[model samples]
Target: MQSTYTEGLNPEQKKAVLHHDGPLLILAGAGSGKTRVLTHRIAHLVEEKGVAPWQILAITFTNKAAKEMRDRLERMVGARVHDMWVSTFHASCVRMLRSHIEKLGMGYHSNFVIFDSADQQTVVKSCVKELRLSDANFPPRGVLSVISNAKNEMLTSDRFQSLNAADYRLSKIADIYTRYQRILVQSNALDFDDILMLTVQLFEKHPDVLTSYQDKFRYILVDEYQDTNNVQYLLVSQLAKRYRNICVVGDDDQSIYKFRGADIRNILDFEKDFKDAVVIKLEENYRSTQHILEAANQVIKNNRGRKGKTLFTQKTSENKVTLLAAGDEHEEARMVAEHILWLKSTTDYAFKDFTILYRTNAQSRVFEDVFLRQAVPYRIYGGLRFYERKEIKDIMAYLRLV
Candidate 1:
């Protein structure tokens, strides 16, 4: 019998969705309908495999992605989607900590406040001042970043101190980390990194709590597996250790969050970590032309230590790949602006059809200047999003405090 969720999936995608047991790695290429397969698999587990909706957990990197997955599953299998657990790592940890954190006896309560980046900086600055440290020598932001990295690596302050005891600067940073954590506990607060760190600690300290969750989530699926940090990998590993029914979907080439402590090895070493794991590759391209896929495949092939897959598409296009080089940012921006104008004038393209991408937000200044001079209308997608604005965050902080 054909299920509604499996209607349009290709053979590889169907195989991924119907794989009922064991650890599975889906090397989903770009535009390979990974989200569709993920949602359909969850739907299949409930409707076809006789698994209860509440027994499934689907984790992603962003709350936005979690919401989109939930919405899709809701449409596919109705209101029972509410019974399933679908959330980002941080969010999932937050939920678990709220219920079981007090049991750890770490002086943290269920009502502990979650400190945002700005709040974290404020607390770190206070710790620096209280510790009689020079702000110029030990900047609060840099210190906070080091502490965040330590937490991502699942290192306690004592462990970090012992590991870097020879380095004077690192020793002082460890002191700051210790004091910063003290202040957080005194204020009944937890920083963003603490969410995952504490959960791992909780699981390690309390086997019963870990067992409860490990038994609850019979089937676990992690999206963007390549972007998972050490702490996140630990969290998922602990939960899925018993059942071993974990499915991870990601492209090693898309692992771009290294700066944020994302470990590409998490995906690359999946097969080594899980014995007899089913490996599936989804390399069909649905969003790009043949030329674009070929070009991208060639470029990514040069990347060492990646699971190999070639992306191909049935769709052909007359357009070919174009490479542009400029001596400087000004020239590059000017060239892009001129190309956009030419395309608009010669072809049926509009200013809205032209998009410019840069490595960093700071790099957009030159392009914006060139576009303004050329009278081209453009909009920047990212720049202090509404919730991230100072005033809005301040208001939210006040509400959280209250």
Candidate 2:
């Protein structure tokens, strides 16, 4: 009922939000009110387009993003989102598998345990030890990584064996893979990857289940589409095949998950996957100033094979961005410390207002050492994080065990 949903949007953004039917892609540029458009699009579907809340499914990559989407929708449509599904892919898979994994005819029914990395490592180590393989020869973590890659490719033990049945190392890995899966089944457990792979398995092997889901969720929205892996891409392809009411929002330039095996081509070749797709570009930057947008656009435009888009901001500022060149990393750290002190003394900015960005985890040590030497009160923000730490996972495992 609120026309304000489309009030702040530009022409392209309004087009994306109002396009209710068919496959749609929103190439939301960085700082271009990406999340706002997504939420408004969902709100538009429910409030203005007469779509039932339960028929919509919004999938995000991370729990934090999923939570944000849920919170935003709750504010927009109140309690209706409780019936609709707005959660991470893993969480949605877990929810589906909980109800229908019993359909797989595997012994893994409801109440089957979900194994964390440490628990999965223990199971792999046991299998390695039973096979009399030395840790140096076949490390558990490395073997687990291979299995994970295979699962992400949607390969089963039989399929993997068919591909690598001859090589000795792969033969051993195949044996380990089968053995590890057997151990998981025996323990009534599935690893994190198995959650998604098993959901796909249930869908493929059981047509009724897939049909029910396709019927239930008529509209699907995927945030951060560029960061999806092969298995996730396949899952979305299958789910969205029947309805084809999929709206994916992502920027190819923001596809930085390549190191984590994210398929950047998923966003790059999106139109090819969904034929006759509607593509909308949101180039008006809502967060960044004009100078910042210009600097970022200059750097990202050099990359080839990305969709051509330019970001512009109406916000004008006299402040110009400075690029500092230091002789060495130590001097760079010192300069950063000096700058932070200067900002604190002159400007109204506090230490918390500053965020030190680094390219890699190794770079964090330089900041830590510098902050300590400079007697600056600063806390490192990124790491395994709160819920991902070993201790917290161990506690959850204990509770689940009970």
Candidate 3:
């Protein structure tokens, strides 16, 4: 007597979707249909478990992810999905702040602008010039990164200044940080990081507001749990404190976001963070051959101080992993081009089926040179990320006004 929502889910996935009582951590391996599990869990909560749609919250890091989840949930649960809140932390914070903004004691309205990096730099530059500091040594870009890191750590100017009172160089950056924040407030605005920081502050300073949301979102699902930082962890902890029905899905082996200050500890010690937590591992991978999964597991096992798990696959294929050695990058690029050309010539696979990944943008140049010389029909798959491009930032800043 399997419900339609639970159909086709593996035992591990079914366990995750049905365990709706307490904190649950699903170590979902790649290609394990975690999205299917997530959406179905939401559908189960609404349709089977007698949970209201508005009482459940699904959080992801990107709007694209939020939109995709909403689209899939709509298909699963029909029009009733509109009551649930599916959005990024920033977008969710903006919504919360829109209603309870006056609680901050700051003179900001719901229509306050959200500053982009470009807009932040403009404020930083103004502050540096006003302070008569040399932009060559203490550039706005560097200062902006400092400010961002501080905000990500839930640090205020006063906290940061107290921590680095003796360092003269930091003193200057602290001044800039304070001045930049003042400018944002004066302009009735918040930067991207400010959104989360302010939300946590709102909860901490105003327990009534936190209690309201804690009561509202009885069930919470966080995707990409490994990529959560301190502020995000705080915000989630506060919201999930009351009912404690929080489900986080992530793989510690896939935690490659240390550069962005993502705390791998959040996923590594999920049980300690939440009481009576149930950990589920979705080890069955539907994509790739068993050989590939074994190879990937072998490579990732060398990482120290990580939760141990191996991915398995039922899909058997003739594909084998190969390693190629080349004297130079040109040779490497040329070898890849030859392989792709051979793949195209013999197999039914098209150019779309083949992919070449590099460590950085510079590495793509050698491949581009090879593709041009070989006249290989190919397309590079990346450029500056969406928020990194100037045009996109400009448009985003303008949209923040609305």
Candidate 4:
């Protein structure tokens, strides 16, 4: 008996979608239709499992992923999808804080402003200047990073101070963190890290609020569980403490946000955390060829900390994966440009069909230069080329002032 929502899902995906009770862990491999599983599970819960839409809380890593899940659920479950709580972790925190922030006795009203990175930097710079700290020794960005990391680890300014009392540099950073928090409070504002940190604080300090939410959202689903930091893990743990009906979807091999304080142990220790949890591995990839999956599996299997799963695909392609080596970034860019040109000249592919990816934005300069010199017209995706211009930034600053 296949429900409308669960139709066409693979056995592993169906197992993940149908298991509505208890803690579940879905080891979703790359291109393995994890999004489909997530969306279909929500739809199945609402459409077939007789679960109230409001009882489900589906959390993802990014706003875009959240929106995509919501849109997919809407197509399957009609307007009832609106009742389901589908949002990024930050968004969910913001929503909760809006209702219960003042309850924390933090002097912040529901209308507190959420400061962006720029605003946070401005405040950090002001704190540094007021404290008479040398800019070179205690850079604003460095100070902010410390504060952000502390928040990610669920450490308050005082707690961080106490923990790092022996370290002189951290002691100074603790002072900056304390003052920076005071200024944010005075301004009736919170930065991104504060959003998560305060929500955890709100839940911890106010048990009634936590209980209400815990009772309301009976089923909790978190995407990208591998990328959750300590604070995020605590937040989810608190909310799902009562129901214990939590489902986390992540590939430990794909955990790549360590620099952003993502703790891989959250996903790795899922079984230990929920001893009775059901684990399903979604290893059937639909996007890549068999050869590519084999190559990726070989590389990823070397990671000792991961929950082991090998990805397999039905797609058959004889093309072998090519390994390219270059002396430096310049040579790499040139090699890429030359290869792309060669492909365009030999094959029927157009320039629009070929896409180049790099590790960071800084690495794009070499590629952009090479492409320009080679007369290869290219567009940078996700780069703020226009808004990041000096004149454009100046105009924006002036507008904000006016």
lDDT of each: 0.92, 0.89, 0.90, 0.91
Tens-digit lDDT track for model 1 on 52-108? 999999999888999999999999889999999999998889999999999889799
Q: How good is model 2 by TM-score? A: 0.90
lDDT of 2 by residue, 277-379 (tens): 9999989988889999999989999999999999999999998899999999989989999999999999999999998888876676676678888987776
In model 3, which regions exceed 4 Å deviation? 345-349, 384-402
* Best-to-worst TM-score order: 1, 4, 3, 2
Q: Which 10 consecutive positions of candidate 3 have the poorest summed lDDT?
A: 380-389
| Candidate with best lDDT | 1
lDDT by residue (1-402, candidate 4, tens digit) is 577766788888888889979999999999999999998888888889899999999999999999999999888888998898999999999999999999989789999999998898898888888888888999888888899999998899999999999998999899999999999999999999999999998888989999999999999999999999999999999999999999999999999999989999999999999999999999999999999999999998888877989999999998888889999999998998999999999999999998888788777778877888899988888784544668878998999999
Q: Is candidate 2 or candidate 4 better by TM-score?
A: 4
Give lDDT: candidate 1, residue 288.
97
lDDT of 3 by residue, 134-182 (tens): 9997898899888888999999998989888899989889999988888
Please give the RMSD of candidate 2 to the true structure. Answer: 6.2
| Model 3 steric clash total | 0
Off by over 4 Å in 4: 384-402
TM-score of each: 0.94, 0.90, 0.92, 0.94
